[model samples]
Target: MTADTAKNFGPAFKTNWWARAGWLAGFLYAAYAANYLDVSWARFLQGLGNGAAFLAEMVPPNFSRWELLAANLIETVEIAIIASAFGILFSLPVGLLAARNLMPSWITWPFRAFIALCRSFHPVIFAILFVKAVGFGPLAGILTLIFASIGFIGKLFTEAIEEISLKPLEALRAAGAPFMSVIIYAVLPQVLNRFIGFSSYQLDANLRNSTMVGIVGAGGIGGTLFAAFQRFDYDFLAAILISIIALVMLSEFISTRIKRVFQ
Candidate 1:
């Protein structure tokens, strides 16, 4: 090879023996763990047969309880809508406050802390807690999803605000605009599109999670579906699963349309 080619290829071709050894050790450890856990080909074959039987039982979904299914679906949608609305509304102020470039340390720290706390727990866990506190219903689901949305969108929104062009804000300040006016004129324009994107994404995520929170008795079709599974009502479970799929697809389509319109 030419001198330049050899020089360029030298570093690229250099192997890290330590890293390769570590990977080999990890593979050996995984095998040890599998043996310790008693995982074997016999277990794998048994699982496959069980899975096949389960699939066979789920064929020919029952739609006789369409009305009940529809009602649960509606409730799930309501929970998503209400939670998303509140989350978006509340996130705006908190996100703005948490933006380090915009707000003082006193203001930013508390809001950042709150966002962190909200994000620390999963929505399903939050739903369970809320249900325990408020009793079983969609209210718990709504609150859980709201917290989830706040944690996600609020953090992103604050970062977006912080990264904005300060030149426009400086111009607004020089123009003798009040803080709120500066935010409206300088800050809003830069982050509004991103805020829209975040909100839409949160809405989509909340719709999917709302269905899941119900498995914990927070409320929604998941609760009914879980009950059906316990009773071996696979036909009903199949129907519910189909409806959920349709709902998610429809929501995804709507969210895409909304994003396009705003864009």
Candidate 2:
């Protein structure tokens, strides 16, 4: 190689003092937080013993209350389905509007801000607010999951739209097609698979969250589970937990199959 080229390709190693200082600061802060929180080996050992005793109490699961269990499961499933449907429907337009590549800044900024606001709070917090507004019931749970779905699926959909090739879009636009027609022919087809994937995943997540929202009086199996915990009904709590696990697994399997079929 020429001397100039060799010099250009010289060793690419350098020490970053800022990175070293950042790491040191992070370690120091972590140590301080641990001390502030009173975290120690003794506390960990005590927690382990308490956890073991609790597990022992939950040895046998009881499910004699089949009617109650079935009713609550059905309600939870309904909440998830309804929320997923509405959330997906509403998110499509919002997502398209929010795609920076497709829309002008005037259009994209507001929708982007809305999506951000939706995602700023956790579902449980939303459930609390909805419960206060709508009173305790499945309605509150549905609203909570709907916003959660919109926030998550909308962001992903916007990203998917942005990543699509602009060639097809340009071709359709050149053909003097209306805006909706262009979306149908050029945009939807390209992002359909990913949209389906995101929808399915959101549905699964909604199902899990539906169960928990009930704890805050949003209405689902969570209320029952919370009651069991308060009453120290360990066997019943075990049964409820097992049922939730089974439901989550079943939803995952179904979603996987649906994705495979579409693929």
TM-score of each model, in listed order: 0.90, 0.89
Candidate models: Cα lDDT each: 0.94, 0.94
Give per-residue CA lDDT, model 2, range 72-117, as digits (tens): 9999999999999999999999999999988999999999998998
State each model's C-alpha RMSD to the native. Answer: 3.2, 5.0
Pull out the clashing pairs in model 2: none
lDDT tens digits by residue: candidate 1, 115-223: 9999999898899899999999999999999899999999999999989999999998988999999999999999999999999999999999988899999998889
**In angstroms, what RMSD does candidate 2 have relative to the true structure?**
5.0
For candidate 2, the TM-score is 0.89
lDDT at 245, model 1: 95
Which 10 consecutive residues of model 1 have the lowest summed lDDT?
5-14
Best by TM-score: 1
